[model samples]
Target: MTLSVRRARTNDVPSIHQLLDYYAARGQLLPRSPDELTEHISSFTVINEADNLTGCAALEVFTEDLGEVRSLAVRDAATGGGYGRALVEEIEHNARTIGLRRLMALTYVPDFFARLGYGVVAMNTLPEKVFGVCVTCPKFRCCDEIAVLKHLD
Candidate 1:
């Protein structure tokens, strides 16, 4: 695979939204609004193959020691090719570079994150994301997503 990860530009927002929507529609991820995407564009990294965006992920820093990996999605055609892992690795590197002590993700694919060094943790363990975002999420009252965290050195 010639896929490469890079910081997203403003123009990439639409494509990133589309990719996330593709997964959201199928219940693979939560759909984010264009406004939110634009607001957090700098936190994103896209997997590009040639001129196409094959997958995307975002690193949302909550505190000095923590960043959450959210909005991860791989195009259906590109699934099973390690793009998801690549995206998370990219985010993990970003977290480490910024001196975060832990990288977390709330996901339906815990095993995938586990393979990438994340461990299942209690939902309440991440109070920042939980109280900051989950309280407003539709699934907040009955969230089924698994929370995973990877400690950084």
Candidate 2:
């Protein structure tokens, strides 16, 4: 199946929420409410095939030089089809277009990020990330998610 990655529209919010909810429920990522999705809707990209949402990802800017890839998820039926990679590439493209120097993710799939040119880094090194969101996580003191970053420059 051919997939196209595009900037998400307001109408796509429900699909994005559902995709994130699927993975979040399985402990792969954090669950985001529709309100939160609306707040950051502009940061998102969705992969669609013939009008069907196949996957989605978002890039949340933390600073002029840094951004975080969040809420990345691919439908179970869409795995191994490069939808995830395409979504990340789309996010990277946006990051570069906006002049960001780095892109990061807190993920369980370190190998996937590594394949996309990201390197694993210590969570402690990312103060902006830790203080901004990690602090509010229930797993803050014992987080197992790995920090990975890719230089965009």
TM-score of each: 0.95, 0.96
What C-alpha root-mean-square deviation, in Å, does candidate 1 show against the real structure?
A: 1.1
lDDT of 2 by residue, 1-153 (tens): 566889999999999898889888899999999999998899999999989999999999988899999999999988998888999999999999999999999999999999999999998888989999788989999899999999998
Clashes per candidate, residues 3 or more apart or on different chains: 0, 0
Residues 1-153, model 1: lDDT tens digits: 466789999999899988888888898798899999999999999989988999999999999898999898888998999898889899989999999999999988999998998999999989999998789999999899999999988
lDDT of each: 0.91, 0.92
Instruction: Give me the runs in candidate 2 sitting further than 4 Å from their true place.
Output: none
Candidate 1 structure lDDT: 0.91
User: Candidate 1 — worst ten consecutive residues by lDDT sum?
Assistant: 1-10
Model 2 lowest lDDT segment of ten: 1-10
